[model samples]
Target: MKWTRAVHHLTDLVEKVSEMPGTHFRFEVVELWVFGDLLGAPRDLEHIDVALVVDLPVDEVPWLTEPLGAEHWANASRVSRNPVMPFWRSAQAPVWNHRIERPALAWSKADGIAEETLVAVGDGTGELVRLPAPEPDELRKRLDDELALSLAALRHDNQVYTDRRWSPGKLTPYADALWRTTTGYLDLLDALAR
Candidate 1:
């Protein structure tokens, strides 16, 4: 599935959650990514992993870490209770602070609210670690650095995939996806620079 579809799914979930009576959860999407759920099955990858920041009353915070995994649905692998977290606990990344305009996704009941996503990865780290958000100038520098790294990795992967020396077989699609992600980051950098 295209990443857009996954994003739509997230939007729907957010809308639904927001409407539940007495639920004071506020959600902000922070990141979108695609990868094999397991390292051994790269070719069987499906669905986009979304990172979000949710704000709720402190008394209701205990339910956040419940062992409820994800609920498998038609196109989505699992749709678990969206993680409940503090605003600062959202994915830490160098995001360009521009408002996103998705009318359908943005809640209309409230005024002056724009939906956004935070990006993060869970790389086998058993515990959650907090990474503080950097200053605006520092954030720009970090974003620039990350953009350069992504571009360099993309170039190296492109060369490897086309070298004709190594046969990647099924992994070709994976490399293609990586290239797309790299280009996406470049696009983001361009937008931020403007």
Candidate 2:
């Protein structure tokens, strides 16, 4: 399963969640990233990162988390990629960002999102520690940079309009098959202010 299919999977969940009891707001997929951390070279062996935003009640946050976690873990080993973080949460407004990306995973891994599977065997950074909050704009910028290069290369080679960020250009080839095999991941963030 490629990123697109994974996205559809996410949307399926979202639709289900929205129909539940009370206060269900609109949501959007804001980010999608893939990278290979365990792989020494930036060639292969990576993870998929996904993020979505919705305006949901804070009290119900855990409702989404628990179910999503169950689904993610059930499919993690299949992802084959790194720590696939298919995140989704409530936000105030839309995040006008890049469509999809292959390199965003690089930044996400560096930021310690997928360190568990990102590193090679016996490389898990077990135990958690306190850290500063994240800066979405910066990560988004990095994604934009890689996305630009990936798009250019794709257009140059395919000589056609891809329209689909993940598909058009093979920006990240591994993305071509994520739903087939994976572990776990949550790249989504909620911007309450936005």
Candidate 3:
């Protein structure tokens, strides 16, 4: 689907999930990517995925998917360790592997709400209404703190996995990617500050 429609669809879906009876889940759109068309991505890639950072038990996450009424895929929550190969990060990764990285579409949180911008234009005029994006310094400090926590978690996981002679698990790569992205964001913020 087109990017704008995808945003609307995802927003609607998330809202529905939140409003479910007896549901006490809090989620934020940490990342989103709307590709192709007027967007910069190649035309062949036409889809959107919103990465939500949610506070809920992993077992309960499927409840969020059931409302979608589709056979969606999900990975078991664990510390999974795999090869840090660039091949896992390409356009074809989703075909060969299980995951591919993409940019975020909506990323704003205020008063504990996931805020997104919806644009509607048919005539000669348009309107833009969105929660103000977080300030760079705030983002930088947040990322910095997150990176430190991730590193600590990685250290603990490494020790436990080593004791059992077990291979790295999901948390391994999760922490690694967290470190990498957090650093990248910090660098970008630094550049922007200058």
Best by lDDT: 1
TM-score to native of every candidate shown: 0.33, 0.23, 0.38
- Model 2, 1-194: lDDT tens per residue? 44334333333333333333322223222222332231223323224344433344322222113222324432432332334554433343222233222222211211423333223211222112112223687656634443443344333334322344546456443332222112111122222222
- Residues 82-191, candidate 1: write the lDDT tens digits: 32211111233322222211111122224312342211112222112223334777656655655565566566556766664366456655465455546645665675
- Worst lDDT run of 10 residues, candidate 2, spans 179-188
True-structure lDDT of candidate 2? 0.31
Model 2 reaches what TM-score against the true structure?
0.23
Residue ranges of candidate 1 with Cα displaced over 4 Å: 1-49, 52-76, 79-135, 164-175
Question: lDDT of each model, Cα atoms only?
Answer: 0.35, 0.31, 0.32
Kindly list the per-residue Cα lDDT of model 3 for residues 1-194, writing each as its tens digit.
Answer: 44444444545544543434323222322222222121232222233333343333322122112111111211111101111111111111111101222222332233223343323211101123212344566545544543454445445545655554545545554444445444534543454455
